[model samples]
Target: MSIEIIGLDHIQICVPIGEESIARHFYLDLLQFTEIEKPENLKKNGGFWCKAGTISVHIGVEKIEKSKSKRHPAFIVSDIEATRRYFEENNVTIKEEIPIPGVSRFSCFDPFLNRIEFLEYI
Candidate 1:
């Protein structure tokens, strides 16, 4: 039998200082992410979790000073161009528009300087 991995489970992000609080403000307050409760054992890890549609995003704080957060999250949407227009209307700087042959995608940075991609499944 072949392995049947259907879709992505979740993407975990490690933030050393535990920006779970701030993340809530941005993703929940501004972006309207639904806050989720982690397992009891994971409570001590110092992180926040959110869910949007079928996507699960978790941000956990690590205890390393040397290692910094260097990755960005790509959230899925129905329309890429419309989202870009929303960002542009809000004065968000659109970094680049990449046409990947048959995909609808755009790249930009958040106020915190995090690279973000808005993409839609073709």
Candidate 2:
């Protein structure tokens, strides 16, 4: 049988230990994503999950000191300019805009320094 790949089920973003609260503030308070309960089996391991539009976003705990900057998740938003302004007002570092033929977009680092991209279709 051929492989039939469907849509994304989830994306796991990693953060160092003891930074879950900081991550929550960025994801929940700033980004406005709703917090969701992690599975009981996984709760003991730390970190949590969040509902981002239709897909699940899992924030996993890592023991490392620094998070990678290049690898990231790009989210489709309604107004990228407004989103950029919000990030700026919140003091989050905004990276350069990535120009795609029919999209307006920019990238930023989360509280833990993990990269996140926001974009809107033209």
- For model 2, residues 24-106, the per-residue Cα lDDT tens digits are 99898888889998879999899989997796889999887675568788899989889888888989888887477999888
lDDT of 1 at 64: 45
If candidate 2 were superposed on the true structure by all CA atoms, what would the RMSD be? Answer: 1.4
Error of 1 at 52 (Å): 0.6
Query: Which predicted model would earn the best TM-score?
Result: 2
Clashes of 1: 0
lDDT of 1: 0.72
- TM values, all candidates: 0.75, 0.91
Error of 2 at 20 (Å): 0.9
Query: Which one wins on lDDT?
Result: 2
Off by over 4 Å in 1: 1-4, 63-70, 110-114
Per-residue accuracy of model 1 over 3-116 as CA lDDT, tens digit each: 988888888765547556766776676567798999999888778888888888887776644432346778878887888898888677776655777678877754444566
